[model samples]
Target: MMSKNTQADRNPPADKTAGQTKPRGKGKKYLVGLPITVWLVLIIIVPILIMFATSFYKKVGSNIEPIFNFGNYAKFFTDSIYIPIFFKTLLLALAVSISSIVLGYPLAYLVSRKVKRFRNQLYMLILVPLWVSYLVRIVAWRAILGRGGVLNTLLLDLHLIKEPISLFIYNPFAIFIVLTHISLPFVFISIFTSLEKIPKNLINAAADLGANGPRTLKEIIIPLSMPGVLSGFTMAFVTALGDYIIPQQLGGPNGLMFGNLIVSQFGYAYNWPLGAALGFIMFGIAVLILTLSNKASASEGYLE
Candidate 1:
């Protein structure tokens, strides 16, 4: 009995330290993550909460009152001008997403699958625009689309017309063009990454089974790349939806987007409550798009 008791004391139990160790490790992990959690709360959560609360506040004669009401939200639905602009913005954003995908997918496919040499150079060229200032890119577009810009000069030199066309700038088409250019890189990157991740062995196997390039692409590559396509679509849609600068700069009279409307409420309109409501509506739409994209990505992963 004495020997057995001594042995038991020496061994104790395996779980004795296991529980302590696991909890200690978890506690350390939590402690390490605490700063990130705090940062997100302070930067993101706090601001969103503040905006949400402010959305319910009353805007009384250029000053915002702390009074809680649903007037701002109601005003959005009740206002005729707001709803039409919102729908128009939605259609424009959708068009931008489609255009980005159409333009970007070919470039991404060429870079990922077709190109052998100068691939890195091409990739860098694609991303180089992102390094430039956003406003600079907008200004560059203005310069190109402006009356005396390169297009007009080229057209004049070619004798396509006697004069430069004013149709290029300060129109809905100009807005579409600029937004597509801005969004193309993001879509290309997403699709390129997806294409790169496709296992070479799978393609070889398809070839071994006598599958042609087009068939393999249609059956395998395109389906696998759906996640990236969806992700890129979401990014383009969100970027175009919330952009006021491009619309304001290029949209002229017909260029007033939902984002411009929201900005107007905050800037010149002096209606903080209404602005917050509009901003939150946009934020919700972005969140919804992201959520859907994530789910689609996950579903694709599961199928793969």
Candidate 2:
């Protein structure tokens, strides 16, 4: 009669073979992920590092020579023009993000809460605008907002205004309008995904607990969907901050953003060093906002 321990060792667990006791082979797994890891390092990480390195350098004469100097960053900080523009751009992006969220949340909720049969159709409708060319959308808005344009004609026909509003095209308002339209879809999609994750039983349970519509939405829905809202806002904010095309085309003098200024430095001004520094500053702001958002979300237990 063998002892219990001796018998157990003789017949080990079915899931653990003698070979299984040894370390598993990591070779195949690493090989599978190696290509993607390499691509990301080469394409994304390397470029970011290069940009960071270039930010510390200054341009010399008309040549493409970069002299290691902090003057570019110093100029950005001390120069009244750049600092104010940076703040203004940040403010504008925040406004756009807020506006997009405000407009997107309700639409997303409505679509998400609808019957399954209708949900797909509604989602497609919302996404249809994404298929359209961004440039075409901006140009269409330009035509509608231009003097003697559709809006002006309609208002004139209604005798609402004595003359076409000159403030519509080539203005900050135009830039805001275009940016909002472009960003609305991103917010809507993000919020919709979050709304969809919510179990119907939880909502039913809320109702069973005598929770009213407003109370349930405020206490349950909003908190659960906060992650999506934050993500959408971050995406829209960052994109709007770095937007060059819409502002360049629709914006007149007043509509010019920091992105436009950065582009000018790299292009016409031939000040690559200053441009790199400004780009790095923008990167810093984006990182700070994202980090703060992450911390806040984590504190709220919504970062999972």
Candidate 3:
């Protein structure tokens, strides 16, 4: 019996399997991230570096040179033409954002709360315009708002005005209308997501606690959906601020945005450095606004 036990114990230690070993320290974690790291460096990091480098150069007699001058930036701040255009663009973006929110919230709430079976259908309808080419949409609006367009015809039939209003086309009003229509889906979708996240139990709980419909909405639904509202407004604002095509097509003269100015600098003006500077300035302004909005949301206890 002792001899048999000794033999068995001697054979047991003959081999240890590879699967029995513990994993080594930090095994290949960075390797998994290598592709993403390369992509970010290629796409985002390199472009930003190029933009920064370009901002310091100047166009001199058909040649772009690395002058290391602040002339571009200085011109941006001191030039009367560009500065006012920048402010106008900011105001226009703000107006578009606010108007989109005002018009979108109610529609989103109604779609989310009131429509159950047709919710997907309604969402599809809202998003259908996006599937069409953006240029086509702008052209369609132009046709509808033109002098001999549907609006003018309706007004003429109704006798609202003796003549077709030029204000309806090729003006700031046209820009505002087109931009708001383009941005409405974004706001609506954001708010719809927030509305969907609200628990029915919370509404029931509020009702049971003797809170009326308006009180429940004001105290609970509105506060809970603040993050989505902020996100929607931010998206709408940024889109409106950067949009050049809509303003260019629908806007006669005063509807020009900073985007138009930037494009002109890069195109006919041949002022690459100034365009780069303006782009950076716009980036800084957008970052500042987003940061302030985030802080305000946090202060209001709406951010997690």
Candidate 4:
């Protein structure tokens, strides 16, 4: 019996089907992911590739010439108007992102940490505007900011002014306000999610250790919630950066952004190559921002 057991240990029975078949779960996963992969390639990768290819082409007398050149990229650096408008747009986008964070953080903290009974109601209120049509919201803001609109009417009723003021609409300031309002909800949601993810035990532990509320927040909460802050900031920055519609409607002459230039190149100018190049530049900036944000979040370790 000992000799037989020793032989069995040295040489186990060989399974006939060993290594002949693959795991069903792995094959199933690949099969399931195939459609999504194809869809992504079709919608995203293909368009980007086409755009990249087009960026190398040339435009000649209202027709796109298939000529390959670096003129499109060169023009961005050579043109006097493009660089200034791009810098201005960058400043505006930065301002919008900062404003969203400032306005959203406190509200997010209040709702996520302080509120209990009416939490859902307040959350819904914050999110409700998102369900409305973006164009409708812009139009509504127009009505509110127009010459004889609600703001001026209110001031008139309160006897605070003699007539309606044109101070509110068709300006960069109006564009800023509209962009902030649009971005605030997204920022709030992000911060609130981050706050919610904090383990209650951590707070309790801090309290037990005699750390006060402010100290606890400073020492523990803020550090943990940074990933969400970065995420929200990136979202707001990108949203404001690519916005042409808001600038067109509210920005007036001074509101011309980099997006407007890109739009014109594609639209009336019939310069697809230039437009593609400009779009790729903005796309590169966005990708860089996203990468930096991801790295920052990774450093926070809360994201892990």
Candidate 5:
């Protein structure tokens, strides 16, 4: 017969330590995330909520007085001035999106399929301008496109024109050019990532099945890469639409966009409610674009 002590030794007590460890780990994770959660709530969410609240209130004298009326929103619809600028902004955004997609797709494809070596080096080259300050780039463009600037100087020296052209700077076209140049790398990077995800064996199999280069790219590559294209377009469009600085600097009196008008309301106009309403409208449009693009991308994605 076994002793009482022997029976007790065979079965040790269940571990309480293991049970407590999971809860401790969870607590630690929450502790790490607390700062980020607090910061976002205080900075982004709070400000946005305040802005939304302020949108409903009217400006009384120098004070933002509270009112529950749809007059601000109503003005946007009835007033012809704001509506045209808003549509113009949308049109400009669409143009910028198309231009980015067209320019990015080819460069991304080249890097992914054709470049045998120094591929990363090429990517770094594309990213160099991005790392520099955005304001610096805008200023640089201003200098380059100015009447007596680099392009004109070169043209004048080469006897291409009798005088410097005033057509280059302080115009909508200049805004378009600068925005495209800066936003190009973002689109390229997104598309490049998508291209990299594609399997090499698919291309090889297509080739083995008697598919030519153009045929493989047409049916296989382009279909698979549409998501990246959509992403790039959305990014470019949103960035271009929300940019007040670019339009302010480059867009002349006739070329003033929706963003500038919104700024005017906040500045000397002193109409906080109106500005907030316009901002909300702009945000809503951007969100709508993103949502629609996402749906389209999702529908197209399953084919792969």
Candidate 6:
């Protein structure tokens, strides 16, 4: 009976379809991803490929010649004017990023740790500015900061100034203020998310060890939250660097950024190849920033 059972088990009752079917989830995932994959390829990957390819070509009169050369990047390096603007843009972006962290961190802490009941309300308020049109906001800032506008009128009414001041709009200071304000909410959201995920037991453990508020924050909270802060900085810096509309709206010739140079190449200058080259360089820089930040975060995590 045991030998018969063993032989029957080894022979196995086989339905004709026993190992013929494929896994079920693979088909579903492929179908779900098909549209998105196509969209990404057409809209993103294809354009990037075209841009990179175009960057290698030469623009002659109204036409682009298929002459592969590094002249575009070379021109950017050789020109002293654009080179200084690039450095200045880097500095400006850094300043905006740092300012966002400084301004957003306390606000994030207040919402996440202090305001427990109405934290959602606080976050919504932080994001309220995003609901407004960016162009509209810039226009509004122009009105508020313009000569003989809201600020000047208020100052005049308060008898604080002799006449309208042109210090608020059409300058580097205005661009910095606008960019920092625009970036603040994003920075706050990132920090608040990180701060919220911190283990309460760690804080309590430190407190039990006679560590005061500031000391505990310095040693525990800051170390844990540094990842979020770096992320916020990198995002803010990238946004600031890529901005062209704000600079055009509020910046004079003297306050122009690297974006304007790229714009000029594409626009009236009619040099699409050079514009593509500049864009690729910007992309490379952004990728480098993300790579460095990721490496640092990984190293910090390992050390901790």
Backbone clashes per model, in order?
0, 0, 0, 0, 0, 0
User: What lDDT tens digits, residue by residue, belong to model 5 across residues 1-304?
Assistant: 1122232443333344455655557788999899999999999999988888888889888888998777889999999998888888888888888898899999999999999899989989987898899999989988899998999999999999998998898888988888898789999988998788666866776788899999889867887778888888999999999888988887777678888878889978899998998898898888898999899888665322
Clashing pairs in 1: none
Worst 10 residues of 5 by lDDT: 1-10
lDDT of 1 by residue, 167-224 (tens): 9999999999999999999999999998887767667767888889998898678877
Per-residue alpha-carbon lDDT of candidate 6 for residues 1-304, written as tens digits (9 for 90 to 100): 2222323433433433565565468789699889999999999999999999999889998988989999988888898877888889988999999999999999988998889787798799999999999999998888889996899999999999998998888899989999998899889888887788666866787789899999888877777777788888888999999898899999865679989888988867889999999888888888899899878766543211
Write down the TM-score of every candidate: 0.90, 0.87, 0.86, 0.90, 0.87, 0.87
Where does candidate 6 stray beyond 4 Å?
1-34, 302-304
**Candidate 2, after superposition: displacement of residue 302 in Å?**
5.3
Distance (Å) between predicted and true CA of 41, model 4?
A: 0.5
**What C-alpha lDDT, on a 0 to 100 scale, does residue 198 get in candidate 4?**
72
Q: Candidate 6: deviation at residue 181, Å?
A: 1.0
Candidate 5 all-Cα RMSD: 12.0
lDDT of 5 at 170: 87
Give candidate 6's total backbone clashes.
Answer: 0
How much does candidate 4 score in TM-score? 0.90
- Residues 170-285 of candidate 3: C-alpha lDDT, one tens digit per residue: 88889989999999999988988888876676678778889998988897778777777887898889888889999899999777789988888887678888889888888788
Colliding residue pairs in candidate 3 = none
Off by over 4 Å in 5: 1-36, 302-304
Relative to the unseen true structure, what is the C-alpha lDDT of residue 212 in candidate 5, on a scale of 0 to 100? 99
What lDDT is reached at residue 250 by model 1? Answer: 90
lDDT for model 4: 0.88
CA lDDT for candidate 3: 0.83
lDDT of 4 by residue, 49-89 (tens): 99999999999887898899999999899999989999999
Q: What would the TM-score be for candidate 1 when compared with the true structure?
A: 0.90
